[model samples]
Target: MAARQGRFGAQPPRSAAPGRRCVMVTANVDIPALKARHPLVNVIEASGVKLRGRGRVRQGVCPFHEESEGSFTAYGDSQRWYCFGCGLGGDVLDFVQQLEGFTLPEAIARLEGGHRPVPVAAPRPAGTRRPKSAALPPRDPALLTAAARFYA
Candidate 1:
């Protein structure tokens, strides 16, 4: 029997089993170009993460989890983000994946198609004020020692 032809003279996928068929899908996308086009700062802002900083470093609340404190940090120079609170970190694609719950290919396609996630307005806890300086607040030695002991 002759195989059926698909669009562009491509042959239809063949069945591996008597009743089951296997299909292969491929995407031709420039990953570096995609990352260049979608920088971490823009992606973070698009996801409703309000960042505050003087230069390349910005801080905001972790969108992945609820917290009254801001533990999410984005480095504009490196085009990456890391949430100290949740320990999640990565580039723009990772950000999209985490924010939209998309797989690797899905995230890539979403970026290629210029489909950004809807911005979620995060509520600020009362009495929280934006710091005047860009520097992160110093960590408490006591807290650090306790954390070290717990982890150890």
Candidate 2:
């Protein structure tokens, strides 16, 4: 079967590298502004995901992360999203990135309906993780495992 087309209307290019490709698109399209144009209720309805509450905001299952309880919140006023369970929070672009696994530019293009293609970055070789900051400690595998189980 063909891979599904993402929210951006295009699938991730087979030749595109994970990190090198243009993660985001043109800066003129402000994610916040696009988000503002659509109410949270409308977006939620468009997504076809049932929400628990009726109003400007609603809580529902996070499409990005696994959770038994509804910890994802969509805010109509700010056009932003927050997941207390996963600690992943950001504007609509971020939400699309997390939920649909689209690059920043792809997400923007999908949401804004633009045809301009963003440059794709060269792929990095296998087994290389993003460079870590010296100020941050290495992640604890045990902690991550526990969190994964908790979410599951």
Candidate 3:
């Protein structure tokens, strides 16, 4: 009876303000499953790269750079790519990131068929680094004078 008291557990959630009902739905995304199901080859081809056979790897014109010949190689088993022209490589997420200049989350969303907003890098939080105009400590007067005289 206790287990059946609520949809999930015994306690009715306290945050509903007594009259409102709240529901929580979580998706435990299995990355490996997604990777296996959606091959990098498909994603690459969908993005307009024309792949050709090159032994175990598939070769295409380097999407990340301006190249006439095929220099981008995508491995079928690994679901990844590397560029001989630009020397860049990584997994599916990385390829999307490099190709579209989208942030990690944006790339993942695109790969999973989720709605993607404007593709731009996410802003990092401000922390240790100083601003460009941050004042520097006053230089030693003797050192400044010496440097000025040397430059003059």
Candidate 4:
């Protein structure tokens, strides 16, 4: 179906306010892809928070709250961040959400850096057979018997 047209004969995406363009995003967002594209340290530094230190983790003042001492930590390798002062910790999406006062979907949209929505797959039918897991290795009968005797 064609998208609903707004003023000036232009089509507006779902959940968008008047004169604002926003695409309707559904569930099943590729979180790994988003994190890979935007690293936690990079995002924090981009926001003008001066981080100090090297390696996987970096420390800086908590941007969520007022403080002079450094209490915010950003894990570059894991793409996550935490603030000890405010007791807030989470991934990049959580950072954007808290910082911008936006909902999860809005945070995702902002991090995506595009107005387009990620493609959503159709829902699977209930009762679909799941794949069998790998079988466990055989146990040593001799060792088991010895353990049982020792315990007894």
Candidate 5:
């Protein structure tokens, strides 16, 4: 079984059988694609916080870290953030983590709207009983057969 922390700071449940656990983080997420999904105006309208600036990047106060200056910059192409003062940066997930006080897993889950690569239990081989005939001496065929019949 493999355990990983979820966005809410809880460890995700593991599969029944032990094996390699391949965790995919933003496997299908494209920063550019996500950025294009929502326009800057839409984001600005939806956000309670205000933003200022123009051109390719918008400037705002660092919500995740302490900052008196508007050091947080959001890139229009990537729809990500970078703080020169705190050196904190990343895509939407990182931004959410900082803004909402969410863990990595929690932020990812929120961005994804759910969990991905859902945990699945692997089938285990059933145990079988060996026949007594295989363990018995070859000369004692009758006895082995009788023992096998009795066991069966």
Candidate 6:
């Protein structure tokens, strides 16, 4: 089968706005890789929020709102956070974006350090991608049980 050309009788001239070049810009940033590389808990903690509690989850005073008790929980393993007090929950990117009020590109650039450009993750020639551990260790049930009883 042959491709059909448009009303110009052949392929239309590739043109962009008068002064600007028709450059191809891709928005395919490796977000998953970025999130894994930049831990949410570390970022939040670095911002001077005191994370208290134990296990994969930690609670900190909600910076978005005024509260006596801490209601912000940062999940160490997931690199995600949630503010039960205000009901805001999302991934590392979302958290940074919201906190910093930065656009997607700006947030990515900030996370990546404006030194180098971000490259898209190309599809592998081999089989599908395999999930890797985020360096989170397995939880010990016995320890958790002991802690629960102790806290109770």
Tell me the whole-model lDDT of each prediction, alpha carbons only. 0.77, 0.63, 0.69, 0.74, 0.58, 0.70
Superposed model 1: Cα runs more than 4 Å off: 1-27, 117-152
TM-score of each: 0.61, 0.53, 0.54, 0.57, 0.45, 0.55
The alpha-carbon RMSD values of the candidates against the true structure, listed in the order shown, are 13.5, 17.4, 14.7, 20.1, 23.9, 21.8
Best-performing candidate as measured by TM-score: 1
Question: Of the pair 1 and 3, which is ahead by TM-score?
Answer: 1
Model 5 Cα lDDT, one tens digit per residue, 1-152: 46777887768675433564445555766745654554543343244334677767888665455455778777776566677888988765555566567655555565556432122223223342222323544577788899999999
Over 1-152, each residue of candidate 6 has an lDDT whose tens digit, in order, gives 34458886666455666885544322566778878777887667655567897779999876566666779999987777999999998877776677677656667777788532222234334433324425577899999999999999
Candidate 4: which stretches are off by over 4 Å? 1-28, 115-152
Could you tell me the TM-score of candidate 6? 0.55
Candidate 5 displacement at residue 123 in angstroms:
53
**Who is ahead in lDDT, 1 or 2?**
1
Instruction: Put down candidate 4 lDDT per residue, 83-116, tens digits, no spaces.
Output: 9998999998888778778777788878776632
Pairs clashing within candidate 5: 7-105, 7-106
lDDT tens digits by residue: candidate 1, 37-88: 8788887887767788858899987888767688999998888889999899
Clashes of 4: 0
TM-score-wise, the better of 2 and 3 is: 3
Q: Can you write out model 3's per-residue Cα lDDT over 68-140, one digit (the tens) per residue? A: 6789899987777899999999987787778788655556667677533223433334332223435688889
Ranking by lDDT: 1, 4, 6, 3, 2, 5
The pairs that clash in candidate 3 are none
